[model samples]
Target: MSTERDRDPAGRARNARPRDALGRPLPYGAVGEERAPEGVVRPPDRALAEAQELLDAGRPFHAHEVLEDAWKSAPESERQLWRGLAQLAVGLTHAARGNSRGAATLLERGAGNIAPYAAEPPHGIGVAALRTWARGLASAAAAGRALDLRPPRLRA
Candidate 1:
């Protein structure tokens, strides 16, 4: 089975389905599909800034895309940081879409992945705070409460 990474950013395969700005595949007859290009990993500062902007703008799904690029391009030592951030963004996206179970699962998993970075995150990202925030979100979702929590800032 082809994974999401196997698909083109434009979702243009022989059986291309449309996608949203977040790169989410739309249903077969869905309209208004956007062609959001996949993100490229830039310098750490720039990538974090861009991803934070997207998160603050209520676009966690887009943030996930940005972070995914970072995860793909980061050094081995920092891969977990970027991947965790991406997962956190995806968790938020699930929450916003009213998938509480998925939100909880991803949030907890993201927090676990981010735990090691809590002491000294790259670019001064508040990894500890982010993990705490993720935990809170997970708890809320587990309790069946849909929250509209603000995204955490990347800087300390």
Candidate 2:
């Protein structure tokens, strides 16, 4: 039984292995493929608003998808900002999934990536505050405590 991963981009069978939700590879018969979500990148303002909405809805995975689209389509200079936001969303997703170690690592990495943009982040995202929040979350996760903190808003 050939799976999607076993097939190349053109759909030809290969040695590719399928993966599960947590990204662990599955047996040959198991089904799953890593595909980007649909939709073009919206303008920065609209994208931030939409991503924030998803995050607030406790759908950090979806938020990460949205932010990833923005990251892929952003100008070279702004890529880091979008990437950082996406990472943060993924951190939230990991936290929601009860993966404390993964959550803490992603949160800290996201915080570091976003720090340089703190003083003047696009869309007024309060990067500094968000970084502090991420740090707190990381610390809590490292201590084996899960926090249910409110999602940060993207201001302006």
Candidate 3:
């Protein structure tokens, strides 16, 4: 087998390794869950809906990838909101993977990132609600308590 890294059209190396639902890499040639495509830009509405679907399917890792794409491709004014959403999704992934401390930190950080937008949220993103959810989950994670792991609503 060629030991070459997979390359996208632009020649950036992409990990061709298969990943589990939580985004953990599996052994070579192992069949794994389908991954979200990298670097595809989506409008806020479409991105939120797609991420929500992945979250509901218990694929926070995939959700994070979608949100990360949004964050990377969004205009400067919208970067924080997308970043926060991505962080929350990754927080969920950490929690699912049993990294409680990491999960807690990320959840809290995500909440803080989105807090500024609470007063005038854009694209109908539920900033206040998401902040609440992130905080609650953060506390549970910090306490090493079990997480109920409900997906957050992306929009009001």
Candidate 4:
């Protein structure tokens, strides 16, 4: 069986941790170009971009679907990272629907899962803020705050 990680844009790394925009520890490795396992192929960047765009547009559920498709195509080892992002997307979807607690849980898992990868995340996203955001999600859950999955919304 071929895994998608083999075809990741970042290529196959032996236990490499993915990072965020700023450079923090996430739960997975960067997606890159490498030979896929037989019939499997790498997830397209277009899907990831679409998901991100959805998040930007306040459409987390739609974003989740976009990323979910990519995630499923990703390798097993990398799946957690993708799943984490997907869950975070779902959490954000819930948050948009006014479900803070649900959002908190999913976001928390997403952040946790992303931790290992954050150590060496891919390009674009901010690593420090991502980690901080993840931590903030857990804290918000603890304090029962209406957690917002939206990234860097507090900034102006």
> Which candidate has the highest TM-score of all?
3
Q: Give all candidate RMSDs, comma-separated.
A: 4.4, 4.5, 1.4, 13.3
Q: What are the Cα lDDT values of the candidates?
A: 0.82, 0.78, 0.93, 0.59
Model 2 Cα RMSD, 1 decimal: 4.5
Clashes of each: 0, 0, 0, 33
Model 3 global lDDT (CA atoms, 0 to 1): 0.93
lDDT of 3 by residue, 16-104 (tens): 98999999999778999999988898988899999999999999999999999999999999899899999999999999999999999
In model 2, the number of clashes is: 0
- Candidate 3 TM-score over all chains jointly: 0.94
- Is 1 or 3 the stronger prediction by lDDT? 3
Per-residue C-alpha lDDT of model 2 across residues 27-142, encoded as one tens digit per residue: 87668655335447699988898888777876777678788899899999888888888898888778877889989999999889888898788777778888988889989988
> How would you encode candidate 4's per-residue C-alpha lDDT over 1-156 as one tens digit per residue?
233343345565442344332223355545532211222333556656666666676666656666676678877766776777777677666566666677678878877776677666653434446556766875776577766555432111
TM-score of each: 0.81, 0.77, 0.94, 0.61
- Candidates 1 and 2 compared: the better one by lDDT is 1
For candidate 2, the per-residue lDDT at 71 reads 89
Off by over 4 Å in 3: 1-4, 9-11
Candidate closer to the true structure by TM-score (higher is better), 1 or 2: 1
* Ranking of predictions according to TM-score: 3, 1, 2, 4
